[model samples]
Target: MFTIARFLTTALVAILFLATLPVHAQDAAPAEAVAAAPAPEAEAGELDGLENPNIDAATLTLRLIPLTAEELEKLSADWLAIVRASTVDVVDEQIRINNTSAELVEEAARARLTEVTESRRALFDKYSTILDAWELKGGDAAKIAGYRTYRSAIIVEETRNTDWRTLLAQATSWVVSADGGLRVATNVGIVLASFLGLLLLARLVRRTVRHWAGRIPNFSKLLVGFSALAAYWLTLAIGLMVVLAALGVNITPLFALIGGASFILAFAMQQTLGNLASGLMIMVNRPFDEGDSVDIGGVSGTVRDVSIVSTTVITPDNQIVVVPNSSVWGNVITNSTASETRRVDLMFGVSYKTPIARAQAELEKVVRSHALVLSEPEPVVRVNALTDSGVEFILRPWTKSENYWAVYWDLTREVKDALDRAGMEEVEAGAPPVVAPPTGVAAAS
Candidate 1:
């Protein structure tokens, strides 16, 4: 009865101590607050003004119109004033001058700085988003507005009052004007000739860039490919700009539209972009080549081709597998053919009745006699285990990676022949056999 009471008292004390102890965070079991899910990337349903019937298309302000030189100077002055007023250093100086140690005053000043920075960021985002939306979803009305407001808005629309006689006279002039037709022909010929010259120039630029990239020592595939691609695209863009200038067409809208579309598409294709980045890393690092035997991501096969987006591998069973560069880059890659020589580990067991010295000598002799095995790192033969049925021995030999399987197969047959010739009893069938389990290298590259 006394022991039982003492036990109860101990239990009571333990419970009290446990109840008073502070909580600790555990790795496996998390707090309820930690289980909160993250917010989604985008909100569901259409945006506020996008599909609203109340909002007119004309009322949407997509971009600001270009300003004249005088107007631009005044706007620059005003912008400078606003920036000076919002500068954190200036605000902090003013707060220091007030000499207020009150927490509220300090907080107010910090809050003001935050507001200024946040407002500037918000304004930049607002303009970019507006431009993107106008490029993608805006209709004919938005396009007209863009033409009218953008800098170098060169599109001109002719307007006139006309009657039947006036219209007939205009038509007659166009039909009969030989000089006007000659001028038109001349301009067309000049534009065509200029375009041909620009095409040749673009080709020259592409070749030069490719040559320069090729001259770089230890250049990666990604760098070479990107340099060529970028140079070609840049030349094309320049050529387009030249043509537009020659024809008096506006160049701003083309770039603006492309930039906006690229921005929107970037968000939509994030996974693909990630894969591309991974591919770049692979190209730069080059863990495996086109004909390498690699084991990765639970698959063992010979790599057939390594491209930007995916790597193609042919398995031993003649099956083709295409893996994304992202998966390949993010996993451990074992390349068997990476080195010129590979160590082939072999295990053999012998009957306990056999002489350990004679068996070891014979095993080493058999491996050393092999023509393909390298002598620089001599073959190793040693007792590895003493099992219930027999003594296990291991033989390690170095051979050319390409000759690994051939050497293994030959050694297996030769060792069996040599043992048979010597008439020595081998390990019993009940035991792990004299030969280890079958092992194979990757199929021919």
Candidate 2:
């Protein structure tokens, strides 16, 4: 416990010390500046964050002259005004000491000219630093200290130096530069070759998957389609990364940018992404396929197209309806044509006096005789309910899915006609109740 307290006390002291540092630095900065005692050459580095270039000139003045900071500031400002008012180019001109009668030799004249030229070049370079900073950084507001300066001077110098052939030759030389052609060609060729190879491989894999999927019924459509798309796109994505690496591009920043963009897009398209996810689930589960008649969300139609985001359904009237996959997956889907066979439910009524056994037999015989009805399951007819109107008998039959509607209508018409021919009464569906003679009482005389 004592050791822990000691450790805590030390930590608190460290924190307090850190918190006071910036305050002390701010307080001390002005006092140190006031002291103005120039240290060694290394101490000249203190003149930072000066916006006016004149401060830089004053700093040079301070380095050269032993003046107090106050006097230096005033003197530098005065000198800056004096320098700005006058053209300083005269300082770079050759000093012509009147040398009559071989007083100054040719060699001495050449040396003086070289010194003058060097001084002019140095002055021009110093002035160009501001312009170079702007141009190189594309007009960056912040000026960097001690950057290389040449562009502004070169541009001015070239106004009199324009020779189209010379410019073309220089540009040509740059094109064939050792760092240009070989590296770029090698990098680009590698990216292209790798991409092409990957695409071919993906295509091959897709074809292989689809080859096997073709033998299966209704199971392989979604699997094969998505697999082909995924193979190609996944290969493309991986190839893109490899291409970036080959081109000496940093992929870390690319990934970070893509991640940020993806977050925003996913959030903005939440419903769309839900639909996309639901589409994938639909494909995997094989709920319905293209060209199947389905009843989805109270809308019955033939599925014309199934895409990742939405399903297109063509209604019986040839009206096209597009539904989001999210809605389709969330609601009940009745795929009418998915199965090989379908059961047709139909109802007919008869008088209660009619023999239920005989009625049931005749109904069954009528349904079985239909060519579209399947024989394996066998048609069934039975008295399902008895109402005040009549005895309700249901006829249930199995038929090929394609023949469902046709068989239903045909059997209905044929059954009615055959029953009438047999002199049997079929109680019309939903008919009112019949009133019979009460208690068999004798009629009034």
Candidate 3:
């Protein structure tokens, strides 16, 4: 009876101790929970800032303007996380809408779906804002594959669910909306301003290059023209890229795409590329110019135009010949009009019985009497050789290149007439009186 009483006393004390402990612990737990939990209003405000549909792209862009690249990256990560969560919510709401049949429940699900969809759209815009900021800081586009993939997925999801009519209506509303209209107007203004600026800069560069190039004695008209045009185009190209970058457009990808395309084209257009390089060399070296009579690649004609791929030549008989620049630069180039004066050579033969001194005198007189012949370097009239036909006399006269053919033809007729009048038997009908050779130095007069 004594042992049973002791056990009951100990058990009674233990039960009393346990009952008091719960009251004290319960009191402390609420204080700790209160300290750990955030304020509901503050948490709601943070979420609303990111998910607010009222925020436009322009507004977000302005807000992000002051952030650094690292800050933008961090913010981009945050917006991506938000977008992901919103995407999940949108998916869940869509499933709920599809699974329900009750009218009120389906309507409620649709409303939730619309809300989450709008929130996701706003989240995507904010994410794009961060990406724009990052690109403006010279960030590479390839580094943001994750960001792009999610945005594209969201777009695909919306496209799959939304009807075309709803999509069109939404597009029209966005275009008419104040934010969208302002953004469009601003971009248009920037483009117009850039275009005008480019025009002005190109004009300025053209004038500057022309003026500067004109003073350089060695620069030909062709080179000067090429230089001025090249400078003008270069200025416009560089300005356009700068304006694009300033408008937050990433042009790095464009360069990469162009580089890749050029690499492939280089192989396919090997001959064209060769001509282009040869054309450049022709321009730089300036072996010939427009209107110059040239013997290039065995084609003798006046150069009409030297384009990037080929040169246009008009022959003496009015035939247009187009020769590839590669062939032109590779072959020998002979410019006939490069000199100021040319030598007109004519040879005359007389009978062996005819006096050599008299024939020489008649040839010299005919040459000197020509109006176009130069008098400074006296005419060369002498016996050059004694051929089987007769004794040969050479008549060499100098004249301006422009008057060369005129003097040549005129002297030929006059010498023949004089020889006929002199009654030389060798100057018969079958035997020719004048012989002009290619070297412009005839063995005979």
Candidate 4:
């Protein structure tokens, strides 16, 4: 009975402990649920974490948080600053490069321009020196490059007296450029003016020469004409040179070129040049005047014309002959008309049987009694030759140059008439009369 009571007490105690434990656990469940549930502040902190990465700092500085408008403005401001800085840097670099390039170009231009200017100045100085020299030597003013320049005067005189007016007339001035070129415009104008003036002066000279020539009737008209032409040509040439000088043209090169070309031409045309030179010599030397009877190159004739290349002559037979000036100058010239009077020689043949003394006396009387015969040089008749058939008598007489032919013809006819009247038969009855040569001289065996 005691053991059953003890086991029932133990069972009841175990059931009571089980029931108490359930009740305590139920009370703890409420406390644990309450602890696990988050507080409002802690939940707010978690909400802050969603808005900012640092939740604690975000919670501590709530007022410091940026608004949407502030954030946009700050971002825009930063972007604008970066853009402005970049643009400024780029612009500065470009400006620096441009400045450097411009400076280099300016320096180069200055250097080149300076070199050119200096070269021009040097050339100008050289030209000035030449001009100064010209002025020192008595120069004149001339236009060069649209500016007035000094030119030197060169005077040439043909006479002893150095007349300034005459020298000025012959003087010429030249405008020489720095490069040795000559200005031709002024020279042409000067030459034209000078030629016109010289023409007027030449007219005066011609009148004077003509008056003088006319006063001398014996002077040849051809000679006077030639002299006038020569004077005119000389004056024209001199005037041309003076005009060229006045116009400021440099004649050095022109003269040199002309001289060289002339030399070449003279050498090439040697025969022509010789003929022309001889002609000029003849013209100047006056070997024979016009109307003078001359024998040239074995040809005897009266001079009709004297020309540069040839001479024209009219023979006594009325035949015309043209002789080259070269031939006349090269050969001997005989001037028959140079003297006031001339002599005539007559020859006659008579039969050998006739008396020589009687023929001589008769011929002398005929020659002396002739009206044209000159008394200063006495007339003479002489027996010259004894030949095969006859005796030759030579009759000589002096007469005026104009009457030579008339006296010769008249004396020959009168002597023949007198011989015929004297009964001198030309032919004998059985023998041939003493035949004479055509020249009235006895023929030689």
Candidate-wise lDDT, in order? 0.57, 0.60, 0.69, 0.54
For candidate 1, lDDT tens digit of each residue in 202-321?
778878888888889876545566667668778877876787555534465677789999999899988878788887888788787767789979778998876667888899899999
User: lDDT tens string, model 3, 278-376?
Assistant: 988998999998888899978999998888789999998999999999999999999877788888887777888988888788778888888899996
Cα error of candidate 1 at position 70, Å: 5.0
TM-score, every prediction: 0.52, 0.56, 0.72, 0.51
Ranking by TM-score: 3, 2, 1, 4
Per-residue CA lDDT of model 2 for 55-137, tens digit only, reads 45334523433334343333333333333333233223222322323333354553444343333333332333332323333
Residue 87 error, candidate 2, Å: 30
Runs with alpha carbons beyond 4 Å of true place in candidate 1: 1-217, 220-247, 428-445
Clashes of 1: 0
Error of 3 at 19 (Å): 69
* Per-residue lDDT of model 4, residues 1-445, tens digit only: 6445434543443332232111111111222221112222322233233232222422323322332323322222232333334434433433443455443544344333333322332333333333333333433222111111110100011111222221221122111332111433444566677788999887777767767875776656656766676777777777777676544445555777789999999889888777777777776677887888899988898999887677899998999998888888999999877788988887777776677777667767777887889888888778666655677777788998878789889988887876677654222212334455688676787
Show the lowest summed lDDT stretch of 10 residues, model 1. Answer: 151-160
> Judged by TM-score, which candidate is best?
3
Cα displacement (Å) at residue 51, model 2 = 38
Model 3 TM-score? 0.72
| Top-down lDDT ranking | 3, 2, 1, 4
Taking all chains together, the TM-score of candidate 1 against the true structure is 0.52
